[model samples]
Target: MDFNPPPYQGTNRILGGKSVTMQDVAEAAGVSISTVSRVLDERLPPSRSKAAERVRKVAQELGYRRDIMASSLRRGGTGTIGVLVPRLSDMVMALVYEAVFRAAERHGYFAIVATSGDDPAQEQSAAESLLDRRVDGLILATSRLDDQLPAQLRQRQIPHSLILRTDGVSRSALGNDEQGGYLATRHLIDLGHRDIGLLAGPNFTSSARDRQRGYRRAMNEAGIPVREEWVCESGYGIEAGESVGYSLLTRENRPSAVFAINDDLAIGVMAAAHRVGLQLGQELSLVGYNDIPLVARLPIPLTSVHVPFDHVAALAVELLLAPTEPSDPIRRVMPTLIPRASSTPPASS
Candidate 1:
C-alpha cells in the first residue's frame, strides 16, 4: 500500500525532460528499439499483441516518440522516389506524373517531383539534384532517345525507369503513338477526304516523328499523295498549331482534312478555321491525337485518339522497382480513336 507505483516519479511527465526514450522503454520491455518501434507503429508480430500494447502504453507513459528521419537514415534509404518531367502543365505529363505518385505511394515510397522544361541540360541538373537527395530510385520522362542521359545514368548507378520518351538504357513505357496517328488520319480518309494535311510537332521528338510517319503511311496505303506543302512542321503546343493552321488554311489549295499531332494542336487549328469563316466538321474535316480530357466538353467536340496514361505509367514504375534482367523491352499501351463532331465526309461524298 505504501508503494503506489512509485508516486509517478518519471522525469518525462511533461514530455520535455528527454529523460525516458525508446531505448529506455526497449530496455524495460526487454527488446530492441526497432522491435519497440515496430510494436508502436503496428508493424510487429501478431503473437506480441498483448506485450506490444503494453510496450506502447509504457512508451506513452515514458513520453517516447520514434524519430522517423533518423530511422530512415539508419536503414540507408530515404524511402523516396525522384520524378522528373518535361512539364507538368502538359495534359499527358500531368496524367503520367499523377500516376507515378499513386504508384510510388502504394509501395511506401514518397515521390519528389521536378520539372526540366524539356531542356537536356536542365534535365541532367534535375537528375543530379534528386541523386543528391539520396532517393532510392527515379522515374523520368524528360530524356530524349539519343540523349546522353541513359549512359550517364548508368555511370552514376541510378536505378531508374523511363517514361513516355526513352533514352534506350532501361525498362521503359510508351503509348501507341504511331497507332494513334494512323487512327486519326484513317478516320479522315474514310470520310471521303483525299486532300489531307498533317500538323506535325517538332522534328526533334520521337512523338512528332512517329505520329507524322503514321499519317504518311495512312495516306500512302490509300493512294493519296502526301503533299509536302500540306505537311506543316511546328512546335507541338497551342500557339504553334495556331500559326501553322492559319498558314495551311490560307494556302492556294486548302486541305479538305486536317490531322494534328495532339489535342492542343487540334483545338488551335479549329480556332484558326473559325477565324477564317470556315465551319469545322462541315467545310473542313479535322482530327487530332492524345484525346485530352477537355476535348469532349469543348464547344465543338474533337475527333481524336486516346492514349492510356494509366497503363503506361504503371508499367514504367513497375520496371523501376523490379528491373528484371533482360526485361521485355516491347511493352506498349494501345490507343483508341474517338469520333466526335470535328470531322465529316468531303462535299463530293
Candidate 2:
C-alpha cells in the first residue's frame, strides 16, 4: 500500500475539521511560510505591507491560531514568564501581577507567579522552581535592597527584570516612589497640616526607603521639622498600620495628619483613628499610596498616590526581553495624587 499524504485542498479547509496551520495560510495568501510566521507574530510590530495584509486576512479567514506552545518549543523557549511577588494578599502585588499577566498576553507570552513571603531564602527557592520549569524569563516584584537573587541570576546568564523594588544594580521598572511620597506628604502640608505623622513601610525595600526620602525632602522644603517620634517603621499591611498608628495617635501632641506609605496602611490608620475617637478628614486627615480600588469606596474616601501598574508591567516585560542591556537600567513611571474626602484642612485650620 502507498503511504502518501493527501493533496493540499484550498485554504478554506475548516469544513474538513482539521486545524488550520501557518502553512495553509501561507499557501492561501501566496506567501512563504517564513513571511506568514513573521506577519502573524503578535510579539513583533504589525506590518502594513500588502503581503503581510494578505497573510493576516487569510489567517483570519482560515481560523488559524498560532500554536504558542509548539512554536515556543521549536524556538527553544517555553514562551512563559515567571513573576515573583511578596504575596498576592497585598492588593498592590495582586494589581502588579494582573497587569504583568495582561502585558505578557499582549506579547504572546504566558505568565505565572509565586509568593516569596518577603523572605530572601523563599524568594530564591521560588525563583529556582520557576527557572526549572524552563520559563523564558522572570519579572520579580520582590527584590530587596540587598537582594542577592538579581546578581545570582545575572551570573547564571538569565534574563530577568525587577519591578516595584530594586537592588539598584538590576534592570528595574517601578513608580517614582520618592515623588509619590513627596506628593502624598505635600498634599497634607498644602491642606494646612503642619504636624504630620508618617507610617513608613519597612526599610529593607528600596521603595519604602525612597518614599521616606521623598517625605523628608518635602518636610525639609517646607521648613517643617520632622520629629523622630512621628516617623514609625512598619510592615506593609493594615495590622502594622493600625499598631503603629495607635502609638502615634495616642501621643501627647499627636499629628493632625498622617501619610501612610500604602493604602493598606492608610486603612489601618483609619481603623486606629476610629478606636481613638478621631474623625477622619476633620480631626485626623489621612493619605495613602498605590490608590487601590477599595480606598475610593470607603466611608471617607482616601486620598492616595496612583501608581500606573500597567505601564510599569509593560516596561518590565520589554526590559526583560530586550536583546541588549539598556543604558538606563532603572525606569520610574510618575504617579498621580488623587485627593478625596479623607484629606482636608485640619479642624484647627
Candidate 3:
C-alpha cells in the first residue's frame, strides 16, 4: 500500500487530526499571531497589505477558522446582547425586539432573545439563563413599575438596560407614554368630543400609569371632568378592549370618542363598535397607541400614536454599553400622533 497524503485543497484540513488555530496560519504565512488575529477580526476594517493577503490565502489553505468565543473572551466581552421581552407573540413586543436586533448589529454585537410571558418568576429564570450563556449585557423589555429585577441586577453589578418600561432606577429607554397619551386624547378633544372614554391598561406598568395621568391632564385642561366609570381599567389585549368597549357603548351615556392606550385594545373596541351597529368614523371616534401596521389597513383607518422604536432601541444599546453610568438614567423618545379616518369632528360640532 502506498503511504502518501494529497496536497491541501483549501478545505478544513486538520493537522494531526486537530482543529487549525491562528498559530498554524501565522507560521504558514510567515507572520505573528497578533497580525493574524487583527486581520481575521471581522469587526475591524479589512487590510490591503501584501502580508494581509498572504495571511488570508494561508488561512484558507490551512482551513483555519476564528474562534469567536476565545476572541470575545480575550476582548473582555462576549459580543452578544441578551434581550428579554414579555412575549414575542405580541406585535409591539416583536417589533421592539426587531429594532433591538438591528441596533445590536449596528454596534457589532449579536442579540439573543427569550420570552418571559410577563411573569416575574419566568423573567428571573430567563434572565439567569442568558447570563449563564455569558452574554455581555442584557436589554429588558418586561420591566414594571414595582419590578425588583433591575435592583438585583444593579446589586450584582451586571450591565443591563431597560426598554419599553422601567422601574425608574435603572438605565432605561422608552417612548414618552404621557405625551403619546395626551396627543391621542387631545386629538379627540379637538374633534369636539367632550365625553371621551379611555381604555386604560393595567397599572402594573409605568406606561399605563403615565398614560392615565396624561389622559387626566388633557381632560382637566379642557375643563372636562373625567368620569371615573369612563376610565376603564383593562388589560393590554384585544379581548379586554372588547369587554370594556361593550360596556361603555351599551351604557346610555356613552362617550362620542374613545382613546385606547394600546393598538390591540383599539382593534377590539372597533369590533365592539361594529357589533352595536355604530358607524366608525361618523358615530365613534377612536385613537390607538403604537400605530401598528394592521390598524392602518382597517376599513376605517385608526388614528394612532407612532412610537419611534428604533430610536429607543439605539438608546438602550448605548446605555448598556456606556463606559460610565450616564447622569440621565432614563431616556424617553417622543412619539407623533397619526390622524386617520377613525377620528373626526362630532356631528354636533
Candidate 4:
C-alpha cells in the first residue's frame, strides 16, 4: 500500500481548515508581525507603501481574515452599538430600529437590539447585558420622563443618546409631539369641530404630555371648551384606544371628532365607531399620529401626523457616535399633518 497525500486544491485547501491569521500572513510574506498588523489594520502610514502592498498580497493569497473582536479589544472598543426599544412588535419601534441598524452599518459599526417590553426593570436588565458584551455605545428608544436609566448611564459616563423619548437631562432625538398634536387638533377646529375628544398617551411619557398640551392650546386658542371628560389618558395601544373610544362614543353627547396620540389608538377608535353605527368622516372624524403604513390601507384612509422615523434614527446615531459633544441645541424633528378620508367637517344636525 502506497502512503501518499492528495494534491491540495486551492479552494478546498482554503476552506478546509481554521481561519488564516495575520501571523500566518506575516510569516508567508517574510515581514515582521507588527508590520503585518499595521498593514492589515490599515494603520501603516504612507511611508510603508511597498511593505503594505506586499502584506496585502500575502493576506489575500493566504485568505487571512482579521479577528475584529481581538482588534477592537486592543483599541478599547467593541465597534458595536446596543439599541434598546420598548417592543419590536410595534411598527414604529421596528422601523426606528431598522433605521438605526442600517445607519450603524453605513458608519462601519454593528448594532444589536434588545426589547424591554416597556418595563423599566426589564430595560435595566437588558442594558446591563449589553454592557457586559462591551458595546461601545447605546441608542435608547425607551426613555421615560421619570425613568432613572438615563440618569444612571450619565453617572457612569456611558456614551448614549435617547431616541423617540427623553428624560430631558441627556441628549435625545425626538419628534415634535406638541406640534403634531396642535396640527391635528387645529385641523379639526378649522373644520368646525368645536367638540373634540383627545385620546392621549400615558402621563409619564413626555411625548404624551406634550401632545396633550398642544391639544389644549389649540382648543383654548379657538375658544372651544375642552370637556374634561373627553380627554382619556391610556397606554399607547389599540386596545386602550378601543376602550376609551367606546366610553366616549357611547356617551349621550359624544364629540364630533377625536385626535388620538398615535395610529394604533386611532385604529381602535375606528373599530369603536363601526360598532356604534357611526360613519367615519361623516358622523365622526378621527386623526392619528405616527402615520404608520397600516393607516393608509384602512377602509377609510386615516388622517395622521407623520413622524420622521428615518431622520430621527439617523440623527440619534450621529449624536451617539460624535467624537465630541453634540452642539445642536434643537433636537426635535418636526412632524407634518397628512389629511385623508378619516377626517371631515362634522355632519350638521
**Per-model TM-score versus the true fold:** 0.79, 0.91, 0.83, 0.81
How far residue 38's Cα lies from its native spot in candidate 3, in Å, is 7.9
Q: Candidate 4 — worst ten consecutive residues by lDDT sum?
A: 4-13
lDDT of the candidates, in the order given: 0.79, 0.91, 0.89, 0.86
Better TM-score candidate (2, 4): 2
lDDT of 1 by residue, 233-308 (tens): 9876788888999999998899988999988888889889988998898899889887888999888899989888
| Residue clash pairs of candidate 4 | none
Backbone clash pairs for candidate 2 read: none
Displacement of the residue 124 alpha carbon in candidate 2, Å: 0.9
lDDT of 2 at 235: 97
| Candidate 4 lDDT for residue 1 | 83
lDDT of 2: 0.91
* lDDT rank order: 2, 3, 4, 1
Off-target runs (Cα >4 Å) in candidate 4 are 1-71
Q: Tell me how many residue pairs clash in candidate 4.
A: 0
Clashes of each: 0, 0, 0, 0
Model 1, stretches more than 4 Å misplaced? Answer: 1-76
